[model samples]
Target: MDLYKIDKQNMEKIIGSNFDLERGLQNLIENNLELTLGLEFVASEFTVGKYRLDTVAYDRDLNSFVIIEYKKSSKYSVIDQGFAYLNTLLNHKVDFTLRFNESFPEQKKVEDFEWGQVKIIYIAGSFTSYQMDAINNPALPIELFEARKYKNGYMTLNQIMKTSIPARFSHTHNQHKREVADKGINIDNASELTAPTEEQLLETSSENIRDLYQSMKDSLLEWDSSFEIKPTKLYIGFRLNHRNVVDFLPQKNALKVWMNLSKGELNDPEKLTRDVSHTGHWGNGDYELKIKNDEQLEYILSLLKQSWQQHRIEH
Candidate 1:
């Protein structure tokens, strides 16, 4: 995409600047991890065994760890390095867990995190075609992002989305499997490695509640294509720009919704939302509402829209 500056009603092409050092890029991303990637900054230059990771971030929504690597040049193999980092994280779970506990005031057990949802993210000015192809498989827990810094202190970070869906590897090579096995890595099926499926999450609700949840979900998606549905162990979250805008937890008779807004941030005229800021809750934010039927679906959607708009503006 071309960027331009309007100078006296004329267009001036804005040139992008290259990052002089990898450290600068790392610092920029680490400081703005939450705004850019919706992740909590954990540690920088975190060393595990022989490898020194660029940035170690935690995903609060997924309850997982994200390993980020910044590169000034696209000379490395993303697949090999990504898997190696994953292997390191899985092998040294205790070290990572201890690091998290030490970094934050709240202490959590190692089993509290969703280890299977752990993923690697590579950020560079550009990526090679081969590197892009390496992560074409949907089953791969790897993401590529291109970060560009332009003049006038403007910067843009965009994910390099895969163009094609490649077939998954049917079986691992005997030698490769043996090598990973020796390193104490179990190559489990991809299905078992992620969070609960949407279908499974909805199974907890009755047929009417499921239908109501689906209706709200479809409306949310229709409002914005960028919104994504992320199903965790407790609830299904509707995310905008990787941040949770709203969370839906379907009950046997009712569907619970939580908006990702603070106490005073949301503008509720009808007083439809319950303030859960002082109360302990499983969802993301302070506002919580229950939907037993679709009679007030429109009003509920309006409430959710407030959260979506607030999040977008704040971020």
Candidate 2:
């Protein structure tokens, strides 16, 4: 894609530039990892056994570790390298936990992390067609991102989405095709990494609360095709443009909604939102609201729309 700048009602094309060094790309991403990818930076050049990972990041929402590898070349096999890193982490979970604990003030046990949600991301200026096709499977935990730098001091990083491949394909197809078995690595056993489903999260909710949550979910999904429902251990997150715009936690009697906006960013004339900026919370953002019924569902949706707009702009 091409980028353009408008000046005096005239459009000027922004020339793209190449990253002279892979370290330059790594530094750029690591410094702004939170803003660019919504992940917390852990360690750089992390070494595990024989492998020296470029960047180690933690996903707070998923409670998982994300291994990022930056590439300036298109010769390596992403599938092989991604699985290798995954294997390394799986075999040495304790080391990673120690790193996490040492890097941050907050501490967590090894079991506290969701190992199944662990993934590897490949960032490069471009990827080969063969590499793109390899990650077309929906079940693959690997992601490919293309980072383009412009001469106008601007850069755009975008994920290379998979094609319309059927999700029903055998999950072991890629592993077998890539012959990862030679190294005694098994990618088929993903049962341990499975995350809680939406149905499972709503199992403890009362009938009224379940209905309210369903209504809100259906409305948000229908409102925007880009919205995604990601059910975590604590709540069901509504994501827009890869960022959480809102989250819903269903209780026994009511549905709690957390808007992904800052303390004063929300414009609520009715003053229905509670400011949780200073309080410890499970969900993202500083605004929280509890809804037992749909009496003010429309107004709540409007408030959520403001968050959606803000996330869209910021992202």
lDDT (Cα, tens digit) per residue for candidate 1, span 170-262: 332343344445434577523334435566678768999999988888888887888867777788898888888999998899998999998
By TM-score, the best candidate is 1
- Residue-wise C-alpha lDDT for candidate 2, range 239-282, written one tens digit per residue: 87657889998888888889998878999999999999999888
RMSD of 1: 4.2
List candidate 2 stretches off by more than 4 Å. 5-17, 163-189, 196-215, 218-229, 240-243, 250-254, 261-281, 286-295, 309-315
Q: Candidates' TM-scores?
A: 0.84, 0.78
**Candidate 1 whole-model C-alpha lDDT, 0 to 1:** 0.82
C-alpha lDDT of all candidate models, in order: 0.82, 0.83
Candidate 1, position 211, lDDT: 92
How many clashes (backbone atoms < 3 Å, residues ≥3 apart in a chain or on different chains) does model 1 have? 0
